[model samples]
Target: MGNKLFAAICYGENGKKILTVKCEPEFGIYLRENYSDITLGYYMNKVHWNSFDLNGNVPEMIIKDMIEQSINWY
Candidate 1:
């Protein structure tokens, strides 16, 4: 068997997902313009999702705060 990957998803009252722990499009664009390791989310809505290279230049605290903000959106 092969390994599997899962995402931490946040859902709305309507049972629709508001955001995943992944990055958002607006932030992604800003990060990409300023950092080298930030990119659009794979297998996700490009206009609303983003992926981050944890080993890259972004600070850990910033990432944490971003995730928190996403959660608060729900």
Candidate 2:
């Protein structure tokens, strides 16, 4: 809801049951409402994927954190 990077999904280290971040072209970040669709954004394009390009300025740890966070959410 808030304009910030929130936890999208929570996955295990096993790589199973992956989590996802909702990258809406407008929202700029993921939100709880996105869960309703149950679809991980666009099918072909990663436009809606948990874009590690957050604002075009992201650190490697931040990106890793997003992935880890997603796993936890799952």
**Which one wins on lDDT?**
1
Q: In order, what lDDT does every prediction score?
A: 0.54, 0.42
Predicted structure 1, TM vs. truth: 0.56
Q: TM-scores, in order shown? A: 0.56, 0.30
Residue-wise C-alpha lDDT for candidate 2, range 1-74, written one tens digit per residue: 34554444444345434444644434324432333323333322355454332333445565565555544432
Write down the RMSD of candidate 1 (Cα, Å): 11.6
Candidate 1, 1-74: lDDT as tens digits: 13422234444345543333445556767866776655565456666565555445667776676676555544
In model 1, what is the error at residue 55, expressed in angstroms?
A: 2.4
- Which candidate ranks first by TM-score, i.e. highest? 1
